[model samples]
Target: MSDTLKHLLHPKFLHMTLFGFSAGIPYFLIFSSLSLWLDQVGVEKSAITYFSWAALGYSFKYLWSPLVDRLPIPYLTRKMGQRRAWLLCIQLLIMVAISLMAMTDPASSVSALTQMALAVTLLGFSAATQDILIDAWRIEASTDKDIAMLSSVYTVGYRLGMLTSGAGALYIAAYLGTSMDQYNYFAWKISYLSMAATMLIGIGTTLWIKEPKKAAALVHQTSDYLAVVGVFIICVTVLILSYQLTADFFQSFRNQLFAWSQNRPLSATLTTASQLLLALCLATITARLVATTRWVNTDMIKDVYWSPVKDLFLRHRQHIWLLVGIICLYRISDIVMGVTANLFYQFKGFDLDEIASIVKTFGLFMTIGGGILGGFLVVRYGIMRIMIIAAVLSAATNLLFMMMVNMEKSLVFLTFMISADNLSQGMALTAFVGFLSLLVNRQFTAVQYAMFSSVMTLFPKILGGYSGGMVEQMGYANFYLMTAVIGIPVVLMLLYARKNQVFEFDQQSDQKTSPH
Candidate 1:
């Protein structure tokens, strides 16, 4: 290994890889193992897919990331500092949740298993929380000079963690006699418990690493944001619940006032309108009450939560819509096309072993290499230029898969198409991430970046969820062609944005250019 790589192995820095491993484990456990286990127990494939929604915690983590950034655990905050405290607190929660998920019987009722699967959601939630803090620690612990190395090591570690959980879990389960028609509950129980045991990796790393120097500063700023948000949400929920009362009361009044006409359709309309008016009145009154009420340490409710997001929109009001539009479109082709990759492989007649060998094992390394190359390409050609190229390539790669399905399901052909697709995705990921990095204001780094990222995925995921239906209707080739056609708009938008200079230097660059 190179000395820099070797340095990553040092005791002090080893935690990055450990953290990555920790992050990667839950991913496959929630998706792959859970799916496999459910299938083994004769759960409907559709139901299994629905449970995948449990992983949506990762997607919506940003909604609560602001609180993660600003809130501190009561006791741990005092002892371990902000980042470490949150990391450790959530780590234990995740561990406990995973352990509960492990103990859940596959023989349980669907509702019972679903409730147990919610434990996986909690696990995902805790893992996302840990990720936010880990990211904070990575930046604050390393100098700007070493950020690259830390990122590389952390990514390498994360991928390794994924591989271990995914392939490693399968191998372990097989050994436990849960493989190939065994649906062995005890065996799976043992295997899941085994997975839970591995969380000590994160626990050890959390305790081993020193809290970043800036932890105290972060905690101070995050002061009481959690309490304030909690109270606000509760007040809002209560006010919403108040609508039920108003609606009921208004319905009763309307019925009494128009008893003779109560059987008429017009009377029904009148009741609805009257109830809506009453609800509005009650809501307005409640709003005034909340505004006037001095609830628990109102001083801690600083503008930090919404300020960064508000500032971005206000400053870019001229072209913010256009910029956000480009972000949504850029990855639509890649994500939508990916939705059918496995189905395409199956359609092409590849067996599970062959698919796993080439697509899972070999494709992973190709993706990593592509990501590394993409990073270098971003350095050589600026992110905008490389991103445009990646967008184009991403759009074009769908054609390869479209062509592959017409063939005799050759492994060589499948490998080639998958490799090309993975490369394009890896390159686009790096460049797109760089592009997002350019958009964020450091003042609201967590919130701004999360907002950008969450929005970026939302459109793609929503659109991609329908891809199976698209394939069903149009067949693989036509579906892919449609996906490719969608990419043209993204290309046009990027080109226009470049022409008009819609986005150039973001907050970081502006800070550098500012007068001292």
Candidate 2:
């Protein structure tokens, strides 16, 4: 047998694929599938868009990842080691959140939708936490040479998980709920309940797997744990107080802004931007304040937070800000339009099952193929080159959606659009993931990876939250055009990075650190 095929069948990669699936499942359940459910129950597009913010936990998961990194769970940590113990507990929380969501009927009332949103948000937090642990494990478990292969395997697993949650969930709902016109809460409930059962695959994997050597003996000082806990409490208190004090002012300001501009999307965007800035500023100040406390240990803070970040800046200090900008905006075009994709398909005359079969099932296979191709190209050529090409393809594919908007509602046309979009998305994501894996210093795997992953999604998700409003104000054609235009900056950034030798710097850093 070929070495590549032999490695592909290795138990290590097999475990990673399952972890990827576990991570992928809850993500689409919260974002893609939940959007469909909300729309099915007659929720307004604007409200459905806002619900996307429930997963903002992903964009800020770094704030809490330190605890996951250093602190040990009471009983669980003793049994399964740090990473696996955390994994099992988190998977349980995910199952509970999914079950709770299944019990709540969004079609019943506004309050019920609110309940469902909260449940989804809870699920999002658990899922994001799982991602942190899994990412850390993937990094720590592999050599530098094999990391890309591992990442590819993980992506394949993640896409498979997305398939289950996306197509599988939809099929179950369609099967149980025969009629499309009427609200059938039971059908949706059963679908979610089935998804919750799939968590067993993850939980079982957690039990069966061994912790990475690096994560197994992660002994930290007592003060480190207490300091993280203390700062967390401080940040939460400050955030809540800041919001309470400014809520009404922002509301009035938002109303006046909306009334004056008569642009719902712009007004909402500005309001959300202001609120996020204020909250982040307040949290930073509070965390800084706690840093100087007598009980707090500066060394602990430096090791946990500062060192990982410092390492990155030290490696690419010249292009750090540019690198950050690239990370933040690289996927903006895809995410902004992606949130409203199912809504668009429904409006264009496709039913649930057709969407499930074409968009979810068939499209996902295209995505996995693209991801595999991307991984191969990155190895054969280079990460930055592949990433640049991926960026162009990802942005350019949005135009396909615009064309679909004007075309007849034929299944063939829809399949073509979905195939192109999903393929581009898969390629872009694989390259991006490979690039990030290279950026991480294995010493601070969890925290560094979390920060990079978080930054990449933060801005895109913020813009995505406004997609529905954008589609409402502007027509589908214009919205897609805007999404496509959003890719211009990313392409430009990649070109600039290529010229500035950013990838060269990364290569030098890796060589210096590599054992060989």
Tell me, by lDDT, which candidate is best: 2
Shift of residue 54 alpha carbon in model 2, Å: 1.7
RMSD of each: 8.7, 3.3
Summarize candidate 2's per-residue lDDT along 1-516 as a digit string, tens digits. 498787667798989989999998997788788888888888878778887887888998988888888788888888878999889999999999999999999988878987897798889888999999999999888876667778888888999999999999999998987334866889889999999999999999999898788983546775668767888878977875786688788888889999999987678668866876798799889888887987887777777778889999998798898989989999898888889998998898887899899999999999888888887776666677778988999999999999888888899888888888888888888889888988888888899999998999988888788888889889899999999999999899998887665777346534554578
In model 1, which runs have C-alpha deviations exceeding 4 angstroms? 1-18, 39-46, 105-108, 141-154, 174-191, 216-302, 314-318, 336-352, 464-483, 505-516
**What lDDT score belongs to each candidate, Candidate 1 first?**
0.66, 0.85
Q: Against the correct fold, how does model 2 do in TM-score?
A: 0.92
| Candidate number achieving the greatest TM-score relative to the actual structure | 2
How far residue 241's Cα lies from its native spot in candidate 2, in Å, is: 6.6
Structural similarity to truth (TM-score) of each candidate: 0.74, 0.92
TM-score, cand. 1: 0.74
